[model samples]
Target: MTADHTPGRVTGADGPAPVPAHGPVRAVGVLVPARDERDHVEACLDAALTALARLPPEIVTALCLVVDRSGDGTGAVARRAVAAHGHTRTTVDVIANAAPLRIGEVRNLGARTLLRRLHPVAPERTWLLSTDADSTVGPDWAVRHLHLADAGVDAVAGGIELDGPGRLGADPDPSGCARPPVPDLYAANLGVRAAPFGEVGGFPAVVSGEEHALLDLLRRAGHRLVTGADIVVRTSARTQGRAAGGLADLLRERAAERPVTAVEVPAADGG
Candidate 1:
């Protein structure tokens, strides 16, 4: 079902009692933005819900699926996926943005919605985990973020593994050549502390590179940002994507190369 801005507790057929805003550790809000993602949305939600189910009993979680100008059945498919997974404690919110929104705008919409539902002090304890509709995370995704948060980390830039047939023969360095380091701040596997994220005005309204922009904002503010190779996510390798200059564009460029091995340069700021 679609979500509204109601003030009362949210409940579903198989959902547990409403979780209070106050708790030992703050809650987690997983935000996903999609457009015409009917082919991948269900699988993405399934993987996310599975990972979230592993959180501690005291840590509440919410899944916010923002369907932006989707002419297909993406929203309905996502709702059904949530129902099938049946996590009794995780609340699900489906937002329908009738007008087309940039990827950054859609992410901001979901984050703002979660922010409004959170307690004033919750930001310090809360975490915002973001991923894409074309990606599937590991089972320990939420647990990894929780661990980082407990360690006083302000943000996390996770790694990604490209998958699908499109990636089969698209090796950029076929000659086994070495290439310069590439940045790995993709939104498909990013986590942020609620406080710093909100303080930096969330994500910009740009259609691409918003993840890197947000990371730069957090770094400029002196937030503790870390990169976790263990928290890698599997994302689609298709050349066509929802937004221009996105992962699809990168994949297309890589496919045209002669295949090379590129090393990841650790962030100068340590994260």
Candidate 2:
């Protein structure tokens, strides 16, 4: 395997050490992991490029796409999209891995590649943002996270909304009215500084629940995690998902459990 494609050693979650305060975000890295997402990859890249355009020309930005075990031409599609609509301030890196790796491992690979591309910039001064190939970020997505980082927040956990057919409903009450679902922490909308991320040993190597695991480490280490109410990303609502225990799987389970018409599906709010 080439050096860039080779998997790096994962940092262990050795007991909680004091995480240093971070400085303003001088560089931003957007890590996207895709597997058989040919249809959604272009739109995802477009949305990200638009968001980067909104940032100042001086802020160095990198969009690293790690395509893992995709039968479809997701990697090629991403390259075409970036070549057509890529921003001047943003550099795009597309890495393809045919090995059958889970989403978390693919994400870890993307983070390591991005960090390498943004070298010389201290990890604390760099902001690492993550999103799935099936998700499209808002125009202010990067701005909102960067603002929090500038204010000394170590991480930002944003919310997500399903875009297509299936509507997700929370547990019903005695009155059979489904309560308004609370904003959730979604990997589709998460941001963290490169320093604390490395300190917490990056993401766990699981297919699912890696986001929760990484966040738990941050919390235990006393790192600040600000909920970005204004930073919600729109994710695909298709039932056939790539990850084994992902949103699509949850949607399928919910559908199997109850009648869709019986429960009121919340218009927004999905993890």
Candidate 3:
């Protein structure tokens, strides 16, 4: 079997090269975690692959999907999507986690697997991006993240706009027009350098709020973080999600006011 589909941790000679002190980002590894998300995995992979293609051909880019205890054949569906795209510029791989795991653990697993696959490329110069199976990113998402990294941004927190059909909470205004959402850090839209991510021990193995936890850790460790307002990701509005207290739960918190509409979130101040 190829190393990409191989199980277990990558290390020693088979692992990536030593850390580089400073340089342009030569590689980007994207991680997507799914649990019983057969319906959403295809669109997720499509969006991720398309975004990866937007980057210059010289930059090594890859997408790794971590399917955790999914009985719905999410892994198989993702593989088919990758094959259908047949994208030459980016390598796509899927890992099946038979054991039950939290979203944070799944994300970490996908991150490590992708990072190792990008061997001989120093982790310090690799950008690790995170998204979800129920979300879709625009073609410019990867490019925007790379531009920020190139500008010395160690990590990026992106905004999200609700898509499809569901609303988040009750309209506080009750003026018939929905109030704009207060932007918060979401795993569906996040990016970080592999070095700092590893230094902070990666993401915490929690059910939800892993993204916020990781960013907070990075901040405490003195890393440069910025909000990529242009890197907005469109996430699901199902009102039911993989993790507790996640975006879906937020949306389901209140009864649907009207048909789901795109939520406009205010850009948060940069850290």
Candidate 4:
């Protein structure tokens, strides 16, 4: 899947553009965990809302933005963005976590809220899509997930590209270049089947690497996972980020050092 860097459009490889799925989408929910993201939340939501608007009118789409102990106007900015672009058919809920919660917990909270709102819908039909506040989704993000679900994939580990200068020294090629794959699972761009996600106990409570942890859980459970480049998201390159030991930290460390042989970073399991 080639990413069209154009702000709102994303096209898949060698085919006609994918149309939104027909029939009610059991229930589609986007889970975003944010903290002090006042500068980037609007653009993030703008890109998300545009992708969602293309879904069939009957699909019950919702955006669950969990503001995790934000000191700034993150929640306010998110609410305003939703009001401006969220469709009447879509439900937009902004839930605040008064105390600081780890990334995993924040995402779990958003998922739970979405589950409650979409309770009547069967879990098998429900889809939970996650992205970070600092990232803007491509136009076909949701559409690609739906297509994968239709093709019987239980979860999707989508790819991401650094949006700015900070990048890990190990990164082999420039953004959008074809290259060998690694365990690049990230919450910045991931989607899951609600039933399997619930079965795996959702995201584990971790300070970081929660996305990979969830991927491991799904893999252990024998779910069909699709790791693809078709649904790449553009994420932040800031070194100082909301979570410690995260992508931001790695980027910062790499930027500080000269390019060297990429070290084998251990997975969350310490493998």
**Candidates 1 and 2 compared by TM-score, better number:** 2
Give candidate 3's whole-model lDDT.
Answer: 0.78
lDDT of each: 0.75, 0.77, 0.78, 0.76
The residue pairs found clashing in candidate 3 are: none
Report the lDDT of model 1 for residue 94: 86
Candidate 3 segments exceeding 4 Å error: 1-21, 165-183, 256-262, 266-271
Ranking by lDDT: 3, 2, 4, 1
Error of 3 at 185 (Å): 0.8
TM-score for candidate 4, residues paired by index: 0.81
Q: For residues 70-153, could you state the per-residue lDDT of candidate 4 as single tens digits?
A: 989899998888888746677888999986678898899999999998878888888999999999998888887777665556
- Which residues of candidate 4, in runs, are more than 4 Å off? 1-25, 168-182, 259-271
TM, every model: 0.81, 0.84, 0.83, 0.81
Candidate 2, pairs of clashing residues: none
Q: Worst ten-residue run, lDDT, model 4?
A: 2-11
lDDT score for residue 191 of model 3 = 88
Give the root-mean-square deviation of each candidate in angstroms: 10.6, 8.5, 9.3, 7.9
The lowest-lDDT stretch of 10 consecutive residues in candidate 3 is 1-10
- Tell me the tens digit of each residue's lDDT in model 3 across 38-59: 8988998999999998888788
> For residues 101-185, could you state the per-residue lDDT of candidate 2 as single tens digits?
7667788999999999898899989999999899999998888777766756677777677785565656786799887663356
